[model samples]
Every structure is written in structure tokens, then in C-alpha cells.
Target: MKRDLELLKVILSKVEQQPQGAPFITNKDFSTRDPSLVAAHIQLLCDKHYVIAAQNGDDKWSISRITFDGYDYLDLLRESTLT
Candidate 1:
């Protein structure tokens, strides 16, 4: 599947909002979107070193935290959307 930058941003934002070292955020939390789609985007985020995630299955993910790069990218995304 193609990468979804918007979804990537949303995932980062959600992960950031969670408390430090909190339990992993799963696709279930993103109920509005298809779980596989969310999981795919999450895999991209993990591959990009944006978020730390563990693969639960072929189309499942458990995201734990956002990396420094993740925060930086999220900040840029937020800024770009404002103008």
C-alpha cells in the first residue's frame, strides 16, 4: 500500500499525547480508519524511526513512543498545516 503522510501525522500526534512509557497504542484506538491501513502507516512510521512499534501480526502494530525525529516531523506537519 502507498504511504499516507496524513495518517502518519495523526499517529504521531496520538502517540505524543500519551504519557511517557505508556502502554502501546494499537490500531483499535484509531477506530475510524481501517485497522490494516493504520497498521501499515504505523509500520512506515517505525521504519522511518519516527515511532517505536512492535509488530503483533501481519497487519497489527503496538506503538510505544515517539522518537525525537517523530516529534520534529510532527511539529513541522503542524506548522505546515497552519499556513
Candidate 2:
């Protein structure tokens, strides 16, 4: 779960540096070998209101943006890790 959260943080940071609604491709370099687990992580993010995920009919996913709550959560995580 910790690794998943870290991966999500990385993904969010990358998306933040890009334009709004920019398409993000999930690949070997961008995700874990277990995509099903990653999908679960995304679902949790959505439930927590941290991010919004869109899935096309063909099953492609793109993150729209991160909410303020997401940033706050990540910041708290970072502080804990540093301490």
C-alpha cells in the first residue's frame, strides 16, 4: 500500500507539470507489472476525492487533476517519512 501511494504521488506530480486534461499513457515504465492492483489504487484515490479518473470504452485511463485534499495528504505523508 505504501508503494502504491508513492507511485500515485509520482504520477500526480508528473500530471501537475503538464497541461490540464493532458493524456497520460500507463506503461511498463510508468506502472507496476500488476495493473489490476494499480487499478485498485486508482479506485481508492477516486474514493478519497484525491483524483478523478476517466476510462474510455477501450479501457484507457487518464487522470484529470489532483484535488487540494490530495496535496494535503501527500504533504502529511512526506512529513511523516522525513521524521
Query: Number of the top candidate by TM-score?
Result: 1
Model 1 per-residue lDDT tens digits across residues 1-83 = 87777887889989999987688899879999999999888988888899988998888899988999999989888888642
RMSD list, candidates in order = 1.9, 3.6
- Tell me how many residue pairs clash in candidate 2: 0
Alpha-carbon lDDT of model 2: 0.61
Clashing pairs in 1: none
Per residue, candidate 2 scores C-alpha lDDT tens digits across 34-64 of 6655555666677898876766434345567
Error of 2 at 55 (Å): 3.7
Instruction: Give the true-structure RMSD of model 1.
Output: 1.9
Displacement of the residue 56 alpha carbon in candidate 2, Å:
3.8
> Which candidate gets the maximum lDDT versus the true structure?
1
Using all chains and alpha carbons, the TM-scores for the candidates as numbered come to 0.89, 0.64
Query: In model 2, which runs have C-alpha deviations exceeding 4 angstroms?
Result: 1-3, 24-29, 57-60
Off by over 4 Å in 1: 81-83
Residue 25 in model 2: lDDT = 40
